[model samples]
Target: MLSSILTGIGEATQLSALVANLVGVIVGITFGSMPGLTFSTGLILLLPVTFAFDPVTGISLLVGVFIGGMTGGSVSAILLGIPGTPSAAATVIDGYPLKQKGMAGKALGMAVIASIFAGLVSLLLLILVAPLIAKVALQFGSVEIFALVLFGLSTIISVSSGSVIKGLIAGIIGLMAMEIGLDPVMGVHRFTLGYEPLQAGIDLLAAMIGLFAIPQIIKDLPRSQGETGIKIEEKGITNQLPSWQEIKSCFGIMVRGALMGTGIGSIPGTGGPIAAFLSYETNKRMSKHPEKWGTGILEGVAAPEAANNGVTGGALIPMLTLGIPGDPGTAILLGALLIHGLQPGPLLFQNNADVVYGIFAALFIANILTLIVQWFGIRLFVKILQVPKTILLPAIMVLTIVGSFAVRNNLFDVYVMAVFGVIGYFLERYDFPTTPVILAIVLGPTLETEMRRAIIAEGTYTAFFTHPISAVFIFLTLVMLFGPTVKDKIAARRAA
Candidate 1:
């Protein structure tokens, strides 16, 4: 383990790795600070490019983007009262108020500090916790793995946001799409519809680009002017670092927010938005002067910023150790890992400890770089908001097409991307969550393959429940799926 850690450190410190991390951080900040351009979209657009690099370097680039984007969202939340990303929504409550009070610089400074603090804390937890989880997971058989995948699927409820039924429908659609290709075990065509390309199934990268990027472009393209209405005042914004006393005052809040973010982010489908809002609300409730929370206080900025940035490391835990993504960003990262021929799970740690440890080192470097870059380059990152959507969206569209086509150098993949883009646009238009679709697409094959293997190995369906670990996970799945409905019913009965 020590040898692998040392090797990973060596890999991460290479000149190419350093450059990729720097560029990724800059690009991530640009994407996160611009409204309607999310870091997930950035990941999708850049997914194909990573395929050309070695595993460690490519994953490092993505890690840098993930860390930087989480912090960068606070930029617009403070300056324009519009969160650049959903996770930054809570930051706007106090962040904008601080801007109004001509304390924009102070708010921005504290936000950066809080983000750095929380991010490192989450990283430490990740390093300590992930390996232990993987060690336990190493004992899982096919039945247990199948149950775990079922548990992962149950998380669709958490990501659904508004309607669980809609999320399930979307997930079913994704599962059906995966079924179009040749069966994984039997090697027989299931639903090719007489098309040769369909025999290979939908390309993951193409689907990811279409589902995440195109809808965003279609929504933002109608607005010709960008950042023209928002003005950044120069006077109060310069050299507005927070005082040492203020940082000390918010230390407790930052630590609590970090822990909350890490815990929430470790749960599949919860993501940064929930963590940020939960932390912000919890801090408000715990504060002596709750009334001052939304009125522009340092605690307010620190709470959400810490939690949201903390999610960067926390989300990676499940993705790396369990082959389960915690959020859309990590979902794309999972796809990238598969594209590079790296299967995430316990065996990955056993076989490719160097790569796994390299990722840890990369994340550590990325967080430190994020602090330095955001602290000094605030002015440059803020200017990213001014780029017109008319120009930016068109360029992104081109990237999406190119990225999809580059997957296998097939024009058919490009067509598939366009079709899914239309489907995604309508899905989003109807307020249906698209995350479950992505998750299903990523996890469906594993679920199907593992179930078959489990049944074959045990010669009965009862094996899933007979195994202790599998039974535990299956119980969790049942609770995840039906617990909320039952609780709501009981609440209604009590009210009646």
Candidate 2:
């Protein structure tokens, strides 16, 4: 194993491979930090270029892009409350609050550090125990996945700290919005209202941008001239690392996040957003001050950042080992591999161990580079916060509109964004939480599709409760939903 790793390292260090990896990282980060363009889009755009490169160098480039893109999205999520990629949605929970509180540096620092740590942890696991983990993940069926989505939905309680009922309402609204397109099973149009554009469904990126970004812009526009939105001092901007005590405190949360991300990532079709939400909820439940979760807590930044990046390594396991793309990004990576005359699976690993190891080695290097790049460049990113609302808000508005339209080049998506923006503004005015809305938008389709598939295959709903994994997830969902109330009751009784 040591010799193979060294050989892979040697191959990855060649000049062409090194240059390709660096270029990929820069390009990936550029796409990821911009609203609407995701890592998968970047990979798809660059696929034609990789055709001329060797397999090892080509795959290494894609791997670097994958790592850099995941690391970059949190930048915008923290600073602007706009998730550059779907994976960064959970980061916006506490990240924007931290920025508002003059701790943008701390939030970015934690995100970068957590991303690097989780990336390495997942990479190590990918190299050492990928086959074992993949084997276990393969056991999951539609029933288990449905239960898993339910478990993710149950975390809305943790995210919606102050108003559980409002959160549920927001979640329901999001689910209804997603239903505008064709039904997943029947292929029948349910709620298009006869609009041709609605036939394609509400685009998640557009809806998310409108839901999160437009509300902030609207709020900023009404501020008086003398009122400060975020006070920034040039001298105060420092990329100071967290205190050792702080780091020690969060180490466990980071590890748990890494594990959760890796496990979820290895499951095909389940992506980083699910992992990020799950990890965030787990940390919130385990924290002594659960009430502080959405209020700029460091643990809040760490969990999602760690989990999101961890998905990069985890997603690759199934793709490389089983020839199954774990998510859309990996599906593009699979195409890149096939174009290079390399098929990914057991036999490919045997015949082309060097290429496999080279990709792993490239990921390690890419992560290290991401840490360095983000650390030094963070101040520039943070400076966006210092821009006056007059200029900044308008730019954000334009970006939001452009991003919405860019998803599929459909102008109707921009209208969807406007409608969602109005809804989000009203929701915020009424003190309804928006995270649940985003969460529901993300999980609703999966839940409905998987549940339908499970029932059809089992001929009854009993499989959901009879399958051990599915049952375990169901139990966990119940615990997540009701555990806090039970605890409060116990505390009240003790006081009495």
Candidate 3:
């Protein structure tokens, strides 16, 4: 193990690896800080470019992008009050509030610190536990996978953050949307509406772009005439790093967020958003003064920031160990690996030990570089908030349209993006959260396919409860869905 680690370190220190890692991080941060462009979008865009590189170098580059993108989202979320990626949505809750309080520097500093700390913690855990986790994952049957999907879907309650009914509606709509592609078991087309493009279903990229980006574009249009879309003052922003006292106050929050992020990220289909939300809410619950939440506290900024970045390493665990992607970003990373004639699994670990260890080394370096890059480049990113909303919105719209088309070179996807953009706008206008819809879209196909497989294998739905792992997941899912509400009710009754 020591020799392999050293050899991997040597491989990762090569000139190509270093250059690729740096370039990927720069591009990722750019995409992540820009509205309508996510880390996944950036990865998709860079897929073809990586085909020419060797496995170790190529995967290293993508890993750098993954880490950088996750951290970069907080930049825009704090400065502009708009999440550059869905993963950063939780950061916006308190991040922008701090910006409004003329603590933009402090907020961004805390975000970066928390991100680096959580990222390192998760990366270490991944290095130590991924192989063992993969061994266990090998035993997961269709029933277990179905239950896992159910567990992931349980996060809808936390993500909803407002109306459970609307969240459920959005989730159902997202699930129904995925049904347009094809029936996994029967191969029958259900909701194509006679459109050929519908046969392929809505592209995930298009849906993501439309649902998150377009709504922001439309909302910002009305503010184009103003000096800035958000009216927060940005002066006296020097010394962005947090004080020792502040760090001491937020230490527990950061640790908790990191653990939550790492745990959720290891589960396939659960992404940074779930971790971020869970971390934020959990921190709030644990805080001595919960009422002060959403009022620009450093703890709030730290928790979600830590969780989202912690997801970078956590999501990679399953992706590398079981060939199962933890989120869209890892899914794209998996594609990159396959493109280099590399498969991620236990066998790959044995056959390509150097490459595997090289990836670990590169990720460690990338996280360190991310801290340095963001620290130096933050001033420039903050200046983006001063850009006029008119120019910014149009630019963002054009980029999203191009990105939607770029995924499959399909004009149909661009149209799908437009349609969903309209849908997202209305959803937002009506106060329905779009995150649930996006989450459902991501997990819908997996849930449907796995459930069908589980039923076929067991010949009965009740078998889901018979398997110990599946049963545990099912129990957790139920608790996640209703546990908070029940607790709240009990507390209310006691207060009365």
Give the candidate number with the greatest lDDT: 1
Question: Candidate 1 regions off by >4 Å?
Answer: 223-235
lDDT of candidate 1 at residue 170, scale 0 to 100: 91
Candidate 3: stretches off by over 4 Å: 1-66, 69-114, 224-226, 229-236, 239-362
| Residue 437 in model 3: lDDT | 75
Which residue pairs collide in model 3, if any? none
lDDT of 3 by residue, 348-386 (tens): 676777888999999988888888888887766656545
Worst 10 residues of 3 by lDDT: 223-232
Residues 256-347 of candidate 2 have per-residue lDDT tens digits of 99989998887665778999999999999999999999989889999999999889888888777756554557756765776577766555
**Candidates by lDDT, descending order:** 1, 3, 2
**C-alpha local distance difference test of each model:** 0.89, 0.79, 0.81
Clashes of each: 0, 0, 0
Put down candidate 1 lDDT per residue, 364-430, tens digits, no spaces.
8888888888888888766667665767888998999889988999999999999889889999999
lDDT, model 3, position 93: 92
Candidate 1 vs candidate 3, lDDT winner: 1
Total clashes, candidate 1? Answer: 0
